[model samples]
Target: MTTTVRQILQKKNIQKIITVSPEQSILEALGLMAEKDISAVLVTEGERLVGIFTERDYARKVVLKGRTSKDTKVGELMTQNLLTVSPSHTVDDVMQIMTDNRFRHLPVVEKGVLMGIVTIGDAVKTVIDQQAETIKALSGYISGEMSI
Candidate 1:
């Protein structure tokens, strides 16, 4: 069976996206994130996906540099030229990309348009859930509850 990213979105039921301007200060972005209780925000110019700014970026870029977040723009530190996936792509494909790139977040794009983003945790959960189902099927077969 094929599981598309659209199916995952339908199941995940995510509704809102936190978006920020690239011109905004990292400090301002952090405050917005604290208020929203989200770990990452999509960097946008109008509706375009320019980059992603996450808590990890804050730690590595701002804190490590010893530069004041108030003085640092997200555009200067955000991850650029993002790796993206089509919404119609499979969960396996997403998992592969996330694993290979060692990235926690990925933007979903279609026809050069941004739709949404998925986290590494999301992809891993899907994989674990799928594995659980397989294990259950094997157990059922071993118990002769169904024909294999």
Candidate 2:
């Protein structure tokens, strides 16, 4: 059996979905991210996901372009072409998507509703945990402690 996004989310025990309005100042969004110790913030408009803002966006789009965060709207810099994943997606599936796209964060959506967010760290942790479990099972079988 493969680990699913739902399982990952449950394990993560996400308590809140941190979001910001598209019209909000980039500085405000960055402040929220800093307060939450997160690298990304979901951009929404009345419960509708519009885009996503990340630290990379600020570094490349704002600082490099000489645009002030306080003077710019998140919508102006947020990545509009989002690649989302569903709860049924496997950890490997998401990892592949992230790897191919160079994404550090991915939003979880179910039936057009934003469910949660998954970070690259989450996927890597899941993979590592799964590998450990496999190793443990193999050891148990080799020791004749469990049936194959």
Candidate 3:
């Protein structure tokens, strides 16, 4: 058995999630993000996943080409396709998916309902923490502080 994405689920009781209508201007999306201090917004339509808009999308699709955020609609600028995972998915499975797909964030859902977002950083931290504990255990054994 492997640890599920539920291990890395964002625990904060987020009442407000940054989101923009498909027809809304990208500029408006940016403003919402700035006000909410969020990195990405879950694009939804009355509780349906449509797409996602992230800062990377801005740099890669908009700003580099000098496209005006004010003129670009979110549906045009946002990544219409999305990669998603289930809360029951293992962290290791998520890590492999993220590494292979070059995804930084993944939305966790169960029964098609959005649960929370998990980032690559969170997975890496979990792995690092696990490694540190293993190292500590080994060091203790070598120092005769722990039994074999």
Worst 10 residues of 1 by lDDT: 1-10
Q: Please, what are the lDDT tens digits per residue for candidate 2 over residues 23-107?
A: 9999999999999999999999988899999999999999999999999999999999799999999999999999999888999
Q: What would you estimate as the lDDT of candidate 1?
A: 0.86
Which candidate, 1 or 3, would have the higher TM-score against the true structure?
A: 1
Candidates' C-alpha lDDT: 0.86, 0.94, 0.80
Who wins the TM-score comparison? 2
Model 3 lDDT tens row, 1-148: 3457876674444555556788888899899888887777777787777888999998889999889999998888788778899988877888999999987888777898878777788788877777888889899999999975
Q: Which stretches of candidate 1 lie over 4 Å from their true place?
A: none
Q: Which stretches of candidate 3 lie above 4 Å from their native place?
A: 10-16, 144-148
For candidate 1, write residues 2-54 as lDDT tens digits: 66777777777778667899999999999999998878889999878999999
Candidate 2 global Cα RMSD: 0.8
Estimate the lDDT of model 3: 0.80
How well does candidate 3 match the true structure, expressed as C-alpha RMSD? Answer: 2.5
- After superposition on all C-alphas, the RMSD of every candidate to the true structure, in Å, is 1.8, 0.8, 2.5
Sort by TM-score, best first: 2, 1, 3
Q: TM-score per candidate, in order?
A: 0.88, 0.97, 0.82
Error of 3 at 121 (Å): 1.4
